[model samples]
Target: MLLREIQDEILRLKQEKDIAILAHSYQSHEITEVADFVGDSYALAKKAMTLTQKTVILCGVRFMAETVKILSPEKTVYLANSSAGCPMAEQFNKTDIENLRAKHPDYTVVAYINTTAELKTVCDVCVTSSCAEQVIRSMPQDKIIFVPDINLGTYCKNLVPEKDFILLDGGCPIHASMTENDVFKVKKQYPSAVFLAHPECKAEVTKQADYTGSTTGIMEYAIKSDKKEFIIGTENSIVEHLKYKCPDKKFFPLSNNFICGDMAITSVFDILDCINGKGEEIKIDEDTRIAAKKCIDKMIEYGG
Candidate 1:
């Protein structure tokens, strides 16, 4: 009946049932502890596709579970918490992308991986925060329509100043809300600590960072870097994970307000309930799966 006992049971059940648990970096530490793999959204989905598990419990949001289903249509994908949804993912829809495409016939649409499957259906290619810069720079098109996250699009554009990017008016409200003052305060508090930021943050916030990257990239940098302290400019959950990963190093969050309530809503209990057959399972239509796969496959082919 205890939490430890439940976790043990969940792990045992996962092995007995051939289920792979995939946790996003923004998930709680307890959830990550029980997961088979924990990383960024796209990386977690890609890893799920390669696993031989018949079922995958995605401890993230609705769109993330849908992404796993899109990648591995044969496997059963379940979202740990059905209520957990990304606001940014919900900001754009199929009609929105179609409308944009109609207006700009000559531009190639590059969607951020944090999107609904329906949105992916209309995209020319998909990109993750970590690979967006590289993928966009490698594309043949001179004019790019980066969607659903203007902050990330701007970050990519800054990396490739020669290319013209049409950024959509959508972004993570949590990260977008972060101001230059937050960056200044963090810097002042930890003068020696290196500042690592996520591309989802505003341009001004990212400009003050020592390094800008995805959530996974931030974690990797902190682990590999020689620095003893770091100021993380992303979701607060990441700071929690970093503390456990590197107990010797000091990690400070850019702002306490930079929290994704949706991402944080899912916990180990929800994941266990799903594995026990009491949670909602993510089901995608064959057409949507096929359509969504096109953009994701293109992303893997080009971004890989």
Candidate 2:
């Protein structure tokens, strides 16, 4: 089938099935075009709770679908592709955090929202990239453990230097692959362009950036800034996304290596199959769901 035909079908079927489709910014432009909402994973999860639809189709990864299920336990959630899991989310198990907790009982466990359901259960609070600095600064504890993303932890650490943070050496390999050399090279290529870097990249990379932010942050910075050109430091898809949204603006990739193979796993065809009720159901037991939700609830309670 053609692109338009598939999109029309997705629109028709999702409405017919009482399903809300949520796409992440990292997803392809074609998928985002047919989605009911497109943003970051946690933002999409929060959006899922507000919709009247009973079913939600997550066009992201396993952990994202799990988050949708975590926030809206009553709603039925499906992952567009079952095998599309996040390497960063799965890097550390619950036991790893448990052991860390045992070692440092007084330290607050601050979890990145990209973590697994089980990992969140033992966490004191949760934070998105956009809110990590604020949330961490709000905490009363002097010591904390930020999990799964060393780059993000470092980003947060630099911003909130008053508190002590213990970071595990685990993060998105795709973003971690970027280096300060990439930024300098891209800057040389586009001397006047504003460089927007994601927090997932190394501190060296983000430090050289003109602006450091989340995926949504990067997009908004590019669109709202007066600068007519930008080198997006996140996923390569943001370039296409921003180009489509702002025709007058010029967007370029910081490097060709910024592409994420996992995010690209869910093609329009996968969404088509999902609309046909062929996707995997994200099932978290009630106990884990309830326990996992407390930290997310704390995040919302803390002004996320």
Candidate 3:
């Protein structure tokens, strides 16, 4: 079957089944094209809450689908590709964070939105890559314990230098793998292009970027900027998406290794299968959901 045929079927079935589809920015263009909304995980989750559909499908990873369930508990949420799971999200578990909390009793616990919903239950606040700096700065605490993604934690810590941050050894393997040399090579290849990186990247990599932001933030910046060329430092898919969005502008990947295998695993077929009731349904206990929501609610309060 053709790609468009499957997507058309998915569109027809989702409407027939009263389902809303949320595709993350990292998802394939075909999946995003058919989605009701396409953006980052937290934004997608918030969008789900405003949606009228009783059921939703997230064409992303497991934790992203879990976030949707946490936000809109009344709606049924499914991960379009059951095996698509973010390695960074699973890097730190509930117990690991609990142990850190025990050691830093006076510190505020900030969980990145990429974390498992279970981990958020123990967190004081949640933040996305776009709002981490602002959220951390807004906190009244003098010290903070950031979990799961040390790279993002470091990036935020640098932005809000007044607060003491305890960063552990955890991050997106794909982003962490990039080095200063990779940035230099890319910059050399495209001297005229501005470099935009995601905060999940290593400090060395992010420091070299002309702009560091969330996936959506990077896209918006590139679209609005007058620059004719850009080297996207996150997932390779962004380069492709940007090319389609701004045909006149040239987009290059900072490194071919920037491709996320987890995000790549999902396809339009997964969304079709999900809408047909063949995907993994995300489930969380009432207590866990409520507890996890507090952190996210705090994010909205502080980020706003």
Candidate 4:
């Protein structure tokens, strides 16, 4: 079937079957085109929970799909592409966190949302890229151990100077690879454009940005502001999303090399196949689900 035909079928099936399709900002242009909602991971998951749909198709990475399952366990959640897994999310498992907890008994383990459901089970609280600093700072504890993203942990440390934090050697390789030089080059080319970056990026890149936020936050900021041009510092797919959402504005990529293969792997065909029940459905054990839900729920309560 052609791309348009598949998209038409998705629209028809969603209405006929009470389904909702959620795409991440990093999804392909075609996938985002047909999605009911497209935003950051936490926002998508939270939106999925409030949705009245019977089934949800998450067109993102494994952990994002798992987050939908975590929030709306009653609603059937399907991953558009099972192989689309985040390397940062897979960095720390339950065993690793359990060992870390044992080693640092005095510290509270805070996990980034880009983590497996099992890892969340071992975490004291969960945080997204947007709320990590706020949530971590609000905690009463003096010592904290942040996992699965060293860049983000370092960013948090910079924000809360008084607190002691142990940063794990894990991060999004794609974002970490970006440097201040990329921001400078983009600024030189697009002097009029505002630079917006993701906090997962290295401190140097983030420090140079005109504004730093999560994928969804960046979209909202660009859309709401009168700025006609912006240099987006996340995945390349975001430029596609912004172009669609705000046609009047010009969105430039920070660097041609800044891309998340994992997030970009899922295509519109994968989403259509998932909605048609040919793709894989994410399933987690009840124990893992319940335990993970605790951490996620705490995030909703405190982090929100």
Candidate 5:
């Protein structure tokens, strides 16, 4: 079947089934075209909560679908690709965090939204890449525990040195693979381009970046900037999406190794299969759901 034909079927089925499709910004442009909403994981999950659809299809990672399920417990959430999971999210379980909490009883447990719902149940607050700095700063606690992604934790830690942030050695392998050398190589190639990076990258990579932000933040920065060229430091899909969005502006990826295999695994067929009820439906226990929501509620209270 043709791409258009498949997308048309998906479009029809979603409406008929009262399903809302949420795609992450890291998704392929083709998937984004068919999605009802596209943004970062936390943004898309928040968007899912506002949807009237009885069902939601998260065309991203498992953690993202879990987040949607937590926010809108009344609605059923399905992961388009069942195997799509974040390594970082799976790195630390509840027990590992609990052990750390035991050590630092005075510290606030701040879990990145990339974590599983189970992890959030034990967390004091949830933060997204887009609002990590602001949310972390808003906390009344002097000491904090930033889990799952040490790279992002380091970025936020450096921004607010006054706060004591306990870091873990887990992060997105794709983003973490990039280094200062890669940034220098890309900058040398695109001499006139501005360097934009994600905080998930290492300190060396972020240190050389002209701007560092979330997926949506990077897109908005590039769009608003008068510069005709940019080196994107996030997922490789952003370069393709940006090229299509702004033909006049040239977009170069920081490294060819920036590809995220997990995010790239979902196909249009996966969306079709999901809408057809063949996908993985994310389920959480009532106890887990209620407990998990506390951190998210705190995030909203803190203006996340």
Candidate 6:
């Protein structure tokens, strides 16, 4: 079947079956085009809670699907493609943080929302790339242990200097793959373009960027800016997404290697398989679910 035909059928079946599709910003345009909602992982999870559908298909990755289930425990959630997994999300296990927590007994443990549900159970609060700085600033603790993404932890540390942060040697390989050399090379090519980077990038890369933010923030900045050209420092898919959203504006990738194989693995066919009951269901034990939600709830409270 053609892409449009698959999308049309997905639209029909989702409505007929009372299922909502949540697509991450990193997902392909074809998947997002047919999704009921499209946004960042944390935002998509929050969206799932407000959705009236009893079932949800997340066309992102394992951690993202788990987040939706964490927020909306009553709703049945499925990861469209079971193999779609984030390297950063699975970078560290429970023991790693547990060891850190054991060492820093008085420090608040902050878990980035990209983490797995099991990891969040031991966290004090949760944060997204957009809200990490704000949430950390709002936190009463003088010390914080930011985990599984040292690049983002470094980004937050720069913004909220009052708190002491313990950053682990972990991060999104795809985002960290982008270096300052990529920025300089891209800038040499597009001297007039503004560089907008995701916080997941290495500090050296983000330091050179005109703006550093989440994927949604980067998109919003590109859309609102009067500037005609932008160099996106996140996933390469954002270039395609921006081109479709702002045809008048030109978008360029900071590096061709910024592509995420995990996000790319999910396709519209997976959504079709999901609607036909072939996708992997996201299931969390009651104990883990409740334990995991406290940190997310803290995120809303602090980030709000």
lDDT pick, better of 3 and 4: 3
Each prediction's RMSD to truth: 1.1, 0.9, 1.0, 1.4, 0.9, 0.8
Candidate 4 TM-score to native: 0.96
**Candidate 6 C-alpha error for residue 265, in Å:** 0.1
lDDT of 6 by residue, 156-188 (tens): 888888889999999999998888998999999
Give residue 11's lDDT in candidate 2 (0 to 100). Answer: 90
What are the clash counts of all predictions, listed in order? 0, 0, 0, 0, 0, 0
Query: What's the lDDT for all of these models?
Result: 0.90, 0.91, 0.91, 0.88, 0.92, 0.93
The regions of model 3 sitting more than 4 angstroms off are none
Residues 1-304, candidate 4: write the lDDT tens digits.
Answer: 8889988988898888888999988888888778999888988998998999978999999999999998888989999998999999998778888898899999998899999998999998899988987887777887999998998899899999999999999999898989888888889998999999989999998898888888878888998999899999888888877888899999999888888888878887787787778988889889999999888777777755
lDDT of 2: 0.91
lDDT of 6 at 209: 92
Alpha-carbon deviation at 121 in model 4, angstroms: 0.9
Q: Show pairs that collide, candidate 3.
A: none
Q: Give the higher-lDDT candidate: 1 or 6.
A: 6
Candidate 6 achieves a global lDDT of 0.93
> Candidate 1 on 1-304: residue-level lDDT in tens?
7878878988998999888999998988888889999988888888987998888999999989999899888888899999999999989888888998899999999999999998899998999998888788777888999998999999999899999889999999999999999888888888999999999999999999899999988999999998999999999999999999899999999988878999989877887898888889888899988998999888777864
lDDT of 6 at 10: 94
- Residue-level lDDT tens digits of model 2 in 1-304: 7889989989989888888999999999899999999999899998998999998999998889999999898998989989898999999998999999999998999899999999999998999999998888877787989998999999998898889999999999999999999999999999999999999999999988899999999988888899899999999999999999999999989999888889999988888787788888899999999999999888877777
Better of 2 and 4 by lDDT: 2
What's each prediction's TM-score?
A: 0.97, 0.98, 0.98, 0.96, 0.98, 0.98
Q: Candidate 5: give the clashing pairs.
A: none
TM-score of 2: 0.98
RMSD of candidate 1 to the true fold? 1.1
Ten-residue stretch with the least lDDT total in model 4: 295-304
| Model 3 per-residue lDDT at 179 | 94
Q: Rank candidates by lDDT, best first.
A: 6, 5, 2, 3, 1, 4
